[model samples]
Target: MRAAKRRTSREVRTGNRFAVLRAMYALGTPTRQELAGATGLSFATIATMVTELLAVGVVTEASREDSGGGRPRSRLKVAAGRGLLVGVDATETYVHVDVFDLAMTRLVHHDHAVGEGTSDPDRMVGEIAEGVRSALAAAPDGDVLGVGVSLPGQVEPDSGVSLFAPGWGWKDVAAQALLEERLDLPVHVDNPLKATTVAELWFGHGRRVAHLVTVNLGTGIGAGIALDGQLVRGATNNAGEWGHTTLVMDGRPCRCGRDGCLEAYIGVPGLMAQFGERHPGHRYLEGGSQTHFLAAVREGLEADEPEAHELVELFGEQLGVGLANLINMVNPNLVVLTSWAARDLGRWLLPVAEARMRREAINGSAAVVDIVTSAVPTNPVSTGMAAFVLEGFLERVGLPSPTSAPLRRLAEA
Candidate 1:
């Protein structure tokens, strides 16, 4: 019982330190009083944590902030050059890697294209490693703390094994182990659903809202759910597979081998299929590339082409049903539509979908839910994955105290 109590005490201190660090990152150079307000910790606790962080060089004092009638309080910021984090977003079509500082400022970017319709796990892993190496090459000198990869599927939380990737027909792929072997750095792997949701919670539309749902529409589809300002990962950490839910009985087939799935109608492939039905054998279909086809569609939509208008109207209707179902069921205060498809078409598609959603969702839920496109400045998936790497780094750092192993392991270097 004493051992357990000690363990619990260490965990609580670690959590409190992490909370302080996260608040510091988010608030820029904030005073101790401001951090206390942001993290809901007492001012005394914030001051103690800040002193420890400063002693270890994890944080540094900035210019003092003068109160109206009292002594000036010193501001604090994360030591930007302490370490580096690499984020990889590997989907069915491409691999994008970005290197970020401790403050989450992206410093290097690299991209590697996967072969059209490539599904072989080995080839995809190679592409991902190549992209990560390219980003690391351009990054400034620092110990690369870790690589956080956003893969496209349900990932086993404990082992970092990709349990399923329907698009690539992957099953039980040892993604994290393979990448760590190739890159010789610690790798943290997760699905894009969780990564993007974390990005939104930290820096995007969901930051201020307690209940939020992010609907990702890319080569695939899924939902990232957050309730009470915490990410909801169910048993097995696969709670947000809303794309597989049935939207229409006996409707179009989905890549997951299901009929009438929400993904079947709104994912990139689904939107491409709908576009093909309208303009079969059109010039945009020559390459059989969804990205190329969507680019053409975006151009057409910008010009207000009649066919594009018709296609968007249909797309809006289908997406509306998906959003309405999510809103009614989850009752999120904010619903952010994101990923390649939404990024490309959301300008024209969001209003239509929002109008349709209001009609379908419950009045109370619909009235409160604000549906908007993702506003994250950087790639949401990669940025969120990088956040994971930072979290891991701090976990190793632990809390600054005599009993705590402050500056041990990677933090010491």
Candidate 2:
């Protein structure tokens, strides 16, 4: 009973601290009274938390804001200089990096593309480490939380081993350990689709959504499923590999050695291939210009070109059918689309997809589901890498615990 009470007390204190932190983050520079009002905590509690925050350098007091015809109130603002965060997206063809400060303001970012026949794990890890160091050099301060990496595979929890990346033909790579050893920083690695879902929750549509499904429509298709405010990681932490699901009978070939997979029909490469076939003499294919291809397609779609419109409608219905499968399976409340194909074409395809999804969903489940398009600014996987670490940062005061990882003392570095 005494131990139980101690545990309860600790829970209350932790909850109170998070409430204060979140309120401060949301309100920008708000006074203690405002924080109390926003969080429904007592003045004393707010004062205690503010004192703790100030002592820990998480927040700083600012001069009173000018109030028209009223007494000015002193405000507390987050200390943007407190520390830094680094995020890395270890993608198939590139290593994208972003550095952020305590306030989550992006300070520096860059992309390093992997050349053809050069997607080896050692070289990619070196690129990521070099990218982080380059981004860190541009930061205004040296204090860093840690590095978070998003990769395209099933990741081992707390261990940076990528079990497999079928698309890249990579398996059993200790990316996290290699990075941590060289960079000497806390490195958290996760699947790109899962990281995207977490990023949506932290900074996009998933904030207000309890049950959501986020689809990534890019070079390769994938999804992340969240239910009851928690991401659903299958037994192997690869639950949302929906792209490989069979979509057509004996259709286009996929890299996964399968025919008729959703990825075979709807991903950017597949669509581009089909487009090339449609207009045999089109230069977009010969030039390999995805930008021009998308622009031409969008122009054709807006002009009501029969062929372009037919392609859009057919793919929209197919996507809708895919979503209908998800809806029927999980009945999520919101469906968010992101990535190159989704972001570029989702605006036009959403309505048609949603309509077909409604038509195909069983027992009117689609009525409760809301369809929307969203993306993390700049890069989702990279931003999500930081977001993954940020969620832990928010729950605590600052920096990862030394015991969390061997190379965890980033501030000292």
Candidate 3:
């Protein structure tokens, strides 16, 4: 009974420490008094916890500011560089790696191109490993705790295997194990879109939104849905596979071997194909340069090509129509758009898409749904993957969760 009581006491103390740390971090640079107030802890408790954290270099004094015209109070923030995190983005065009500190700041990033339609899973994993090595070498410090990878395919959360990445022509590949063997570090893998959503929930708009959907429009379309502040990976861990949702019955064939899928219409190739059908005699999409296709379309429109504007409207309308179904069904507070189509052409696509969504949604769900581009800038997917590993490392130190056991092991070492 005495031992039980002691264990309970330790647990409570640990919980309180975590609560104080989270409050301090969320406030960015909160004073001891602010942390006490935010965490509902007594001043003495906050003082004790802060001192312990500061002594160990977990939290640092960021600045000093006068409080209410009185003596300057010390401002505290998380020590961003306490541990190193590595992230790999197994994308279609390139296998990108990003290194970050505990505070989710990218220290260095590099890209290694992989030829499109590379079917050999071993080759793909090798490229990702190379990127990881490059990132690790570039880090200011060499104490990398863990690795997180974002694949453009379905990844099983439990086993961390790449279920499928059509672009890579991979299926049921042991990506996590492959990476672990190469880097000898903890690894967490997930779909790129889902990884981005996880990052947003922890650091970006997630502070305000309890329910949100981030639609990634790249080689294929997929959504990362967070409902009630939890990233929902459905029964099969493919809950937000919005790209393959049916758009037009028996229309165009999609790369996923489906007819009239949304991805078939608005995917990089699909959009280019749609433009070609509308305008004809266009020498584009030949070399898989989606950027060139977009530039040409934009150029034609800039030169007052009515057909170009019409093509833009059609693309936006189709995308909006698809999103309207999602808004009506999910009733999300916000819809974040990513990828070149949504990122570069968002200003033009958003308005038109929102208008169409509002007009098409069954109820007034669209009226309340805010459509915007992702708040996370440049390499959002890779950055998010880095956050995945970094958060794991931080959580073991009583910061945030859900913690990665392997990451905890590496951090301890």
- Per-candidate TM vs. native? 0.91, 0.78, 0.82
lDDT, residue 232, model 3: 73
Pairs in steric clash, model 1: none
Clashes of each: 0, 0, 0
- Report the lDDT tens digits of candidate 1 across residue range 1-413: 23322446766576567667766766789888877777677788778888878876679987887788899888888888878989889988889999998778899999877876788887788889989888888889998989999988799746989998998899999988988889999898988888888888777765466777888988888999877666777667788899999999999998888899998988878877877887899776668888888898889888888887887899899889888888888998889988888998888899999999999999999998898888788999999898888776665676422111111111111
lDDT value, candidate 3, whole model: 0.75
Cα-based lDDT for every prediction: 0.81, 0.74, 0.75
Clashing pairs in 3: none
Q: Which residue runs does candidate 2 get wrong by more than 4 Å?
A: 1-56, 59-77, 249-251, 287-308, 391-413
Best candidate, lDDT: 1
After superposition, which runs of candidate 1 have C-alpha atoms over 4 Å from their true positions? Answer: 1-13, 65-72, 399-413
lDDT of 3 at 318: 92
* TM-score-sorted candidate list, best first: 1, 3, 2
